[model samples]
Each structure stands twice: as structure tokens, then as C-alpha cells.
Target: MRLAIGLAAAAWAVIGSAASAQDYRPTFHPDQLKGPPAGAFNEVLVLGSPHLSDLPDSFRAEQLQPLLTRLEAWRPTAVAVENLSGLQCDFMRRYPSRYAESVEAFCYDPSAAGRALGMDVPTANAEVERLLEAWPKAPTAADRRRLAALFLAAGEPGSASVQWLRLPAAERVAGDSLTAEMAAALDRRMTRKNEVDLVAAVLAARLGHERLWAVDDHTADSATPPDEEEAQAKAIMAAWDNPYVQARKDADQRLYADLEHPDGVLNIYRDYNTPDTQMVVYRSDFGATHVEPSPQAFGRRYLGYWETRNLRMVANMRDVLGRYPGTRMLTIVGASHKGYYEAYLNQMHDVRLVSSDEVLR
Candidate 1:
């Protein structure tokens, strides 16, 4: 009788444990804690933007003025851009087999500027900080030119553009630390339609900021195995064929089509940041990958990369906020990264997520 009773009790315990496991929801929600009890709260605005380089030829650089005016009104104290730091790129340079293609493709080769200035990436990066630390109250055009050249040597053309734009039209010519070749290079950068140049750097310069922060990270990215390339591409593409992907594309097309409207471009940014956009986005991309049935589990591996990349990006953002509390940071990143950025950032105790709709308006 005793043996039979113990067995029945054990069966009930097993059943109860399984039931709880299936129904379990985490009770501790850090996102619910919206504020720090003391001191200034960190205000973060995550702006989702399409790759401006991909926009059609008809899109004018001046078209961004309206959007820029609105963001300027918000007066973000600092702006963080979606470009990898010179230091991170420098670190990745050591591992050629893993990062050769990524470095060649994504990272700017600052060697020429470095050679001209007699500064490697590290020394130039250090000089950038030292100069900024003792930055004068009223800097001359020469001061700006010197910093711009240092920024180029540091492999941060975006920040260099901020300094370039700050200069008077006449003072934009090569002199001081910025060599003639580098000046022409920056002239090219100033004309590029990409948001890093036309948007972030432009706005930062307009706001009187000396430099823009580079917070993008790519430590998670690696060279795809030659054999797995086809499998990986097929799995991700297959996942993207869902209705949500089509709907997202259609919605974006509708928004982009109306760029003639006063707020057409801004409206697209607002739409990308809505709360309802999260699951739709996930289903269209990462969630679909999660459900993909591949023997190689290529989908899961892709998902891991995506999550890890976003997590690291969020950490970089958080690190900035931690260093400088009470900052109104404008983080301009790619649209697909918006949902993940918000979800991860919300968990921080001091960070208060500002609605993009409010700022874009």
C-alpha cells in the first residue's frame, strides 16, 4: 500500500511540474521599473531609418531638411550613429581570416590619411580624445580643420564630416592637419546621400557638437563557411517569403511613394517605430527563421547572429548612457534594428524610451 501511494504521489508531482513549466511566465519585469529613484534619468530616442543610399536617384539631399528641423527642436545632447568605432575595426583587423572581407567591405581604410598625418588608428584615436578634452570655448576654423583631419586618421569620416560642415564655406579647403587629398575625400563624403553623412553628421554639426559617437559593433559577424553559404541564403530567403514580409514591403512602398508630401519621409520613420510593428517585423524575419525546418538548422544560426548583434549594439548604447547620465541621446540606426534596440534598451533601469513619433513631429 505504501509503495503504491508513493508512486502515485510521484506521478502527480511529475504532472504538476510539467503543467507549471508550460504555463510559466516570468514575474520579475524590469521594464516595468521606468525610472531611477534618484538623479537624472537617461532619455533615449531610437530613430529607425531606411538606408538612405538605397533611395532612388530622385531623392534630394535637401529633402532631409524638414526631418532635421524637427529633430533639432528636440535638442538631443548627443547623437549615436550606426557606424562601427575605429577601435573596434582596429581590433577586428588583427583577425584577417575571420574579418578580412568585412573589414574590406564595411570598414573605411584610414591608412592613407594615417600615413599623411603620421598617425595610426590608435594614436589618432587617442589624440582625438585629448583634443576634445581641452577643446577651446571659441574654436577657429583652423581648430576645426585639425580635428577633422584627426577624425579621418581615427577612421571616423562621419565625425570628420561634422567638423567639415561646421566650417564656413570658404574654410572648407585643405589646410592645417587635414591634407589636400583628405579634404577632397571629405568633400565626397559631404555629398553622399547616406544618413551617416547627410543626416547624423549634418545634424550633429548643426547642433554645435564637435563629433558624433560611433556605436555600431560587428564582433558577431564572421566569414560564412563556403559550403554553408547556399544553405544559409536559401533558409533566410525562404523564411522571408511570408505574408508579413510582403505587407511590410507594400507599406514601405506606399510611404516612400508619397515623399512629395511635406511629412512623407518623417511619416515613414514614425510608422517603423510603432509598437504594433514588432511582431509583424519578427514574423517577417527572425520569427520566421525560428520556425524554419532545416537539418543544418541554418535558420537558428542566423537568428543567433541577429540577436547577438542587436544585444551587443544595445550594450554599446547602454554603455554610453551609463558614462554620461542625464543625456538626451539620439540613436540613429537602421529600421530593422529598431524593434530589437527598443526591446533590449527598455530593460535598463535608468533609460526612458522616448517615442519617435513625438520627436519626428
Candidate 2:
């Protein structure tokens, strides 16, 4: 709302006519946005988090408590996590062949896991609270598997896998409907993936939220032919070997190191929300300008697909906000997508972004 085209024309004159006549540059001064309209401001905090579980050996679940505690204080009306919708997970479970990859990734087995837990979706999420409350000091293998079944029942197979992984191989046997195949499904889901949203789920439950929103969209990234995909990746990587990119990589390493300390988690969140971090996302990652035209065009196509996915995810979040006006919502997503999500969500008439720095403090 702060954008003044008339003022922008006057400002353009300062750049000098030597700057290409065809070049388009519209400056964005976000401070100019008139604060949200009267009444309760609908606040949104788009949190960019690394996949914590994927971190090195030093990163433990307990280390996340302080970060979650800080977030819990924000008192979000709703929490949105990066995951497929429960309906989609159900369809994947029923028709595995059609959605084999997704079904495998989610480790959803409605017939077995669903029956074992005895609930679905909103009703099923209650088990999450029960598991948290009744978590044993030194849980037996049976206890672990039971929790795993409960997570699957709650439509959180990723978290279920984390629980199942804690059991010893010999003790990870079939129990009731939890057969070896089901156990393997759980194991497969945990493979090479982090349960980032599990943190979001815990925070939501602590705040008395009924359920978390599944706003991630996979339908936008269509399959490019394998050869074309490989070539595109090669070209993009070649362009990415610059000083700006290297500096970001160095900073990322430092951030990853900070995840080890309990207090460091808050610092990590604060750093991620800074304008410097968000600007790099555009200048180096999405807005890098030196690739040849052909490769650049190919890269642009990939960026388009990425933007489409974020747009759909935002639309899903908007759906939740529409149902409950004046709600404060928190979206927990991968750090790389943070800029895109904020950019699209800021365009919405009613939504206003809450400063993550203030929230961390």
C-alpha cells in the first residue's frame, strides 16, 4: 500500500538515463505499508527452519524445547505444517500404486495403522497429546511400537517413524495389527527425512490447537524428463559457483552449528527472519543473474514451478484464515521456501506478518 508510482517515477530520475531505457526497476519500501486496518490484526509468522532431525549427532529432540517454548508464547490461533493433506494421505494409502512414492514417503497404512489406533484426522490427533503426557522414562519396545501406531493413526507417519526407530531390531516385532510390513513402512518413512513438522505439532498441541493444517503442495512440480532434469540441474549448479553463493554456504554452516546449543535455537530463528537472509534468497538463489540465456530460461522454468507450489501452499493457508478471521497463524516450512511464502502472503489484503525477531525475544 506504500507503493507510490508517481514518487517511483521521480526516484527513477536519480538513477540517471544511462541505466538501460528498457530496464525495469521498481523499488519496494515495505515500511511504507499502512499498518493493517482497525480491530484485531490477523498476524502470520512464516518460520523458516532447517529440517532439525536431519542435523548431525549432536542435535537431539530435547534441544528443541526452548525454541518450542518461545514459539508457544506467541499463542497462534492455528499452526500450519508442511505435509500433505490427510485426505491425500488416505487416497495414497488406498491406491499405493498410483501414488507409490508419496505413499512410501508418508508411510501411511490406513488399513493396518488406522485400525490399530482406532481414530482418524481431527479425532485421531488427541492421541498425540496422550502420548506426550504418558511418555515413559525408559520405554520398552512395545511402548515404542504402540506410540508409532498412534502417530500413524493421527496421520503423522513421519513422527511415527521417529518413534519406531528407537526400538531394537529384535524387539521391533509384530504386535496386534502392527506387522513387520507396517514396521518396515515406518522405517522407510524415516529414511533420510527430518520430522521438522513434529515440532510444529507439539507446539500446536501445547497451545490447545485442535489440529495442524497440512498446507504443502506437491502437484505443482511436474516431472521433467530425466535427461532434461539432469541437464537443468547441471546448468544451475554451474551458475551457482560464485562468491555470493559461497558466502551463503559459509553462513549456513555456522547456523547449522548453532543448532547444538539450547539457547542457540532462538538465535538461529532470529537470524533466519532477518532482511539479510531473505534478500539472499532472492539475490543468490532465485534471482542470480549471470547464467547464459538458454540455461537461464531453463532455470526460470524451475523457479516458476517452485513459485507455483508456494502460491498453492499460501492459498491453502488463506483457506484456513478465511474460515476464522482475525486469527494469528504460524507456518512452519523449510528455510528455502521462506522468502517465496512471505512474498505471496504479504500481497493478501488482510494478512500481516509478525516479526520473527520480536517473537524470538
Candidate 3:
């Protein structure tokens, strides 16, 4: 009788355990059962570049061709540059003085291009279409300059760069209504701050793309008071005193030495987008710990501004990129922004990253 009773209890316990197991439900919903279909995604290549043009001593214009060639083979459908969008253009046009600091720093010449082309942005763009439609099979240097001037007038520097490239090296010298400053600007496209951006524009025009996407955001950035700003900037730089900073400095020294090599330039970008390098950016630059008597209080504020700027910029990219599925896109941004962009963009359902390695190779 005792044995039978024990067996019955064991059976009851098993039955109760089974019932509980059956009643259990998962927290995950059916809607998240699978990711979007593989075909419904855009392949993004985030190329993180240093402001080489800013470091004039370390830049070489001739070294850019190999890099440009590799990027061109990727055949990106859209190229997003780190420039303020048309909205910012409209806002700045309305109140140029408000953004005088940016204008002065960036050397923005919106009207220069327009003035050179002899038409406004819209009219110049229409002329671009017209010229391209009846593009000459064997155009002369003058013809190319005319197209370039029109591209410049339309606020299309990238396309302008392309037209400049079409001219023979001898013809690229001067004259043809192209000013000295404008010539320098076009040459700078291959050397410095706008190098990748200009390359994108060139490739886009070559591929018959109408315009490059301007996706930079700055409205979220807050300016520090001029009097206190210098001290605060120093404090921020002081917080970044670590081996990593030294390591990067060492790397940059090497880069400067190899400025003449295209592979050398390309390597700088490759290493910059690496996961380890990005983590360092977060820890050393964006995530430095601060105490109450924080020397880096302004630094923290700057971090907030940087994040907000990137988030808004990513939103702008999505607005343009999400519409055209399966299109390969390249975002040429400051190296500091690469990690943040990847983190935010990876979460979107329809977007996927193409390893820069694949594209660069």
C-alpha cells in the first residue's frame, strides 16, 4: 500500500510539472519571428576618413587615384557626404550671419559655383541634363570646362570635379573662365577635406546620378561661450591623455610618411573603421568618465551634441537610402562618426552593412 501511494504521488508531480511546462509562453512575439527578407536590404559601406585636407602637410593629390578607382568599382548607387543638406542651405541662405562661424571655418562658397555657371541651382541642374542628353562623343577641353562650370553653378561640386577630371592634365592648368580660387578648390577635391566627397560626386555623375546626398547635421550642436570655450576645449583634450591617443599619433606620423602611396591612404581608412578602433573612440573620446568637479563638463556636453548630430544625420541618410532597396550606398564621414553610424544603422530592418574590406579590396 505504501509503495502504491508513493508511485501515485510521483505520477501526480510529473503530471503537474508537465502541465506547468505546457502553460509556459515565450516573451518574444510572432511579429519578430524573423528579420526582413534578405533581398529587401540596402548594402551600406561606411568609409571613415580623416580630415586629410586639414592636415596639408600630410596630403598628396596624386595618391588619390588608386583609392578612387577602387571606390568606383563598388558602384554605389548613392553617395552620402558629410555636408549639411539642402534644408540647411535654405536656412543659411535665409540667415547667413547666424552660421557665420561655420561659413568661415568651412569656406563655404555656395554662390561661387552659381556665379561661375551663369545660372541658379535649378537652371544649372536643367542645363546639366540638357548637356548630358546631347553630350558630345568627343568633347574638347573647353566643352568639359563648360560642363564643369555648369555643375559648379548648380551647387554640384562633385560633378564639377568629374568634369574637371575629363580635361587633359595640360588643359586643367587655367583659363576657360575658371578662376584661380575655383581651380584650387577643384584640385583640393583630390587632396583634402572633400576628397572622398568629391570622389563620390565624380562617381555619381559618371554613373548618371543626378546629385550626391548631403546628410550632415549641425542644428543640434550647441556653441560654448567664446570666453570659456578655450579652457573647456583644453579640459576635453586633457581627458583624452592616454596611450591610445599616443598610438593614434604614432599611426598618423606613419601615415604622413606614406602620403604618396594610395594603399597607405586606404589603410588609414581601413584601420579607422575597425571594431577595436571604434571602441577606443567611445572610451577615449566620447565615454570619458567625469566627476562632480568635472574638468570635462563641456566635453560631456560636446559628446551629447556629437551623438545628437550623428542620430539626425543617420535619419537623413535613412530618408534617402530606405526608399531605394538593394542600392549600394557609401557614407563618407569623419572617422569619429563611423562607430556611432554603424551602431544606429545596423538596428534598422532593411539595412545591412557591406564590409569596407570587400569594397576597398
Candidate 4:
């Protein structure tokens, strides 16, 4: 009987070893694994993309191809987008007129600004130009009014004559001031516009899945700038006891320290919003709280508001998962979001995390 029991144990050990060996594949490709079951929605792929304007042709050929192959293999039911802000959605459904108003208000008026810049304005795209030429000779009254406001804001008069006017002394001074501010604002807007386009194109090409879900929360405001380094340090120190946050800080420090730039530390600092002044405070605070040495305090804080916002985002993703049941999802978001997203999603019983490196490569 004892001999029979020993043999049984040996058989179990051998089986375990074989299973482990089968699971451990050294290759980097996603094709190394089989797709999830047809009725099972168990996997998710998250990607990080540089702004639309920054994506080069090389990125499409090199990075995007592998990602496409993985998505095709997985055959997700839907592709989610980061666009579709609240304002955009509102315009889509209830407020069609307001939506049209907003679009006209937002776009740059080429005719007025082009003439002021001493350039002959070319028509817009063929479709737009064709519509404009065939139209009631002018834009709709609302569109015309909106364009006039935009033109005035851009330091070009909506009236053709005012566009060419040599401004009177006082008006010229005000115009100069407005022109400087408008140019700066325009530059910033243009930068963001290009980035958005780049991200959209890459996602569209790679996923090709219809029913794109826009999961972003438009209400969340931009991150506040840390007033000083020390303030930022204190915020980082505050999270020291949390193992996950500590691991992230350690990784960021090692990455930044290796850089040659004096401002290298600033990358981690800015990422965390840690001010230098708060560093000593965090150091002292963390030391008092623990007996052992700890990772360097990076001086960034994730406040209560940020935590709530992230929780909502996770809930949104879960809701989408529930609705689609078995469909794979690809989430593209900022790098700072990587930790929170992974932590929340990893806890779910049905979810499998696919690394960006696996997909991108």
C-alpha cells in the first residue's frame, strides 16, 4: 500500500512539471498562445500611443503590424476609442444645432486669416470647397457669425476691408496684444489636434473593429502643477507604505537616474507632481513610520480626487466588459495610468492582462 501511494505522488509531480513546461514559452510573439474560447471574453490588450502627429511611417510598419496580428488572432468584438468627449456626445444626440455651432466656432477661418498673413487662401478639401462653391453663395448665417467671431479673435476682421485696414493707433495696440495671445493659443491647439489625429489613425488601422467605445471621462480636469519639489516629495512619501506605489517609485527612480540630463530627475518629479521642498518632509515622515530603509521619495501625490476618477474609469471598463461578454478590448491611455489600470483589472476573475510589449513588438 505504501509503495502504491508513493507512486501516485510521483505521477502527480510529473504531471505538474509537464504542465509548467508547456506554459513557459520564451518567444515574444502573441501567436505563441491560442485565442480565448469563442464564447469566452477573457483577455484585454492595452496600448500606449504617441500623439498622432508624432507617429512616423516606421511606427506603422514596425510597431503596428504585430499589434494588428495579435488583434486579428484575438478577434475582439469591439474597438474602443479615447475620443467622444462629453461635448461631442451631447452634440451627436440632443443638440445638433449647437454641435454644428461648436464645430464652426472651433475651426480656423482660412479666408480671413490667410489674407491677413499675406497669403492667397487655397480652398479647403475638395468636398468642403465643392459644397461651399455650390452653396447659397455664403455660409449659413450662424456659421458666418461664428466664423466672424473666430476671425475677430484671430486678429483678422471678418469684414474684408477691416482685414486689410491699417488699424488706428489705440486699436492697433490692442490688436497687437490680441494677435500675440491668439498665436500662442493657436499653436497649443494645433499641437493637440495633430496628436489626436495620430492616435485615432493608429487605433483605426490596428483594430479595425467596429462599435468603438469611447471610455474616457471628459469631466476630469487636467493635473494640477506641483508648486515646488519639496511639496511633491511629501506626496510621494505619503504613499510609501503601499507596496505597489513603492515599486512604481523604485522603477521610475532607476529609469531617471540613468539619464545624463540634469533635468532627468524632473521627469519622475513631474510624473508624480512632487515638489523638491516636500522631499525632506516625506523622507522624515516615511523614516519615522518605518524602521527599515525605503525607496527614495519621488514627491508625487495621487490625491483623493484622482483615486475616485480612476475608480470610475475602471467601473466604466467593467461595464463595457459586461455588455460585450467575451469580446476582447484594447485600451489606449497615458503611461501614468498603467499601474492603476493593471491593479484594478488584475483582480477580476475573468480578465487576462496582455502586456503592451507583447502586442507592440
Q: Write the per-residue lDDT of candidate 3 for residues 1-361, one digit (tens) a residue.
A: 9999999999999999999999999885543432666675677889887876655465665556666778888888888888764346545555554665654454345587677656666677688779878886787787777777776666666666766766677787555667767778787775445554545665665665545777887776444677888888677777787676777778677766776675777777777778887877777677763321355477667777788989998898888776677778888888889988987887666677878777776
Which candidate wins on lDDT? 1
Task: List the global CA lDDT of all models.
Answer: 0.89, 0.70, 0.71, 0.43
Q: Among all windows of ten consecutive residues in candidate 3, which has the lowest summed lDDT?
A: 287-296
* Window of ten residues with lowest summed lDDT in model 1: 32-41
What residue runs in model 1 are displaced by over 4 Å at the alpha carbon?
1-28, 34-37
Candidate 1 lDDT, tens digit per residue, 235-340?
8899889999999988878888887787777777778777777678888999999988989998888899899999999899899888888989999998889999
What are the TM-scores, per candidate, against the unseen true structure?
Answer: 0.92, 0.67, 0.71, 0.38
lDDT of candidate 2 over 49-71, digit per residue (tens)? 87766566766666777778878
Clashes of 3: 2
Model 4 lDDT at residue 324: 65
Which candidate order results from sorting by lDDT in descending order?
1, 3, 2, 4
Clashes of each: 0, 0, 2, 18
